[model samples]
Target: MRKRVTMCQWLSDKIDDEPEFLDNMWFSDEAHFLLSGHVNSKNNIFWGSTPPDHCLQRPLHSVKCTAWVAISTHGIIGPFWFEDDDERSLTVNTERYIQVLRKFWVALGRRRGIDRALQWFQQDGATPHTSDRSLEWLQQRFEDRLISRRCHPEWSPHSPDLNPPDFYLWGYLKDRVYEHNPQTIPDLKAAITAAIRAIPREECRRVIENFARRIQ
Candidate 1:
């Protein structure tokens, strides 16, 4: 808690100094959308008199897609799905993460007319994000404006509440996407994409305002 407060204060100070900090800060994270979707076992009750064998077995290889999104006051950069060269869903590694930023962030930034030099990138201290190579790549692009571990204005550990995507976007997306109850990977991805597209730009601006209040 002490560390979190310290980091929050540091960020608050930075924001005070630079009014556009939160606007220019691109906060990012990723979440996995499972084909099974979010299970609420609490609502499950056996209606039979005999107690049947009650174990539900999931598949050995369940289909899912890891979706990444980066949000700023401008808009969302992506619902970028992490996949291999063959288009199979894959976990994020340093190489794959860099590729996503280079491909989605760079290309999308250009299309959106966002100045790369003015953007402050914020990411949690995930393994791939904190890796030496990944940090080097991020530094080359964002330099001293990064909000991450081992970077300027280092993000506090386990402080997802400080990030807009964690405190707002993910829950909002998941609730809407799971309503579709997608039974296949493609359906799940489609649901996620639709949900993301449905988000209003005003909502995103409000989220950034909420983030500013949070750190303050």
Candidate 2:
């Protein structure tokens, strides 16, 4: 809690010092979408004294996919699907991450009118994200407009509360996506995309604008 508070303070101070910080920033993260929707254990409360009749059996293995998405105050960017490697399992390597970044950069310009040179990108410290090759690629394009392990204004470890996607956007989308209980991978992907599209521009702006208050 102390670390989180300190980090929040640091963020708040930065935002105050640079009023244009939020406007030019893009927040990015990856999330896994499972065939079986995410069931929040805390929301499974039973009212009966004897206990609920439901028995939730955990799946031994579930079909899932990793998707990378980015958002700015303007709007949401790519919910790009990660390509599976030789093992036929989706894993983000430096090369794959770079590919997503390249595609997402183009999408940002076409969809949101954000130029790579004008935006400050934020990403968490996943292994692929922090790799030397990935860092170099980001540097070449975004120059100093990056927030990562090897960049200025680094994100703190294990601090999901500071990330808009983790704290708000993903949860919001999951709640809507799971409403249909999508049965197949394609259905799940469509549901996820639809949910993202449904998010209002005002909501995006509000979340981005509220960052300073949240940190405080």
Highest-lDDT candidate: 1
Runs in model 2 deviating more than 4 A are 1-10, 39-55, 85-89, 111-113
Whole-model lDDT per candidate? 0.81, 0.78
**Could you list the CA RMSD of all candidates, in the order they appear?**
5.0, 3.9
Clashes of 2: 0
lDDT: worst 10-residue window of model 1: 37-46
Expressed as tens digits, the lDDT of each residue in 93-140 for candidate 1 is 999899888876565557566677788888999999999999998888
Indicate the TM-score of model 1. Answer: 0.86
Q: State the lDDT of candidate 2 residue by residue for 1-216, as single tens digits.
A: 665565567678878899877888888998877777854432234577786678878676777777789877888886888856532337788888999999987887686455656778889889999999999988888898788865676677776776888877888887888898889787888888888888887888898877657777
Which pairs clash inside model 2? Answer: none
Q: Please give the lDDT score for candidate 2.
A: 0.78
After superposition, candidate 1 runs with Cα above 4 Å error: 39-61, 111-113
C-alpha positional error of residue 128 in candidate 1 after TM-score superposition, expressed in Å:
0.4
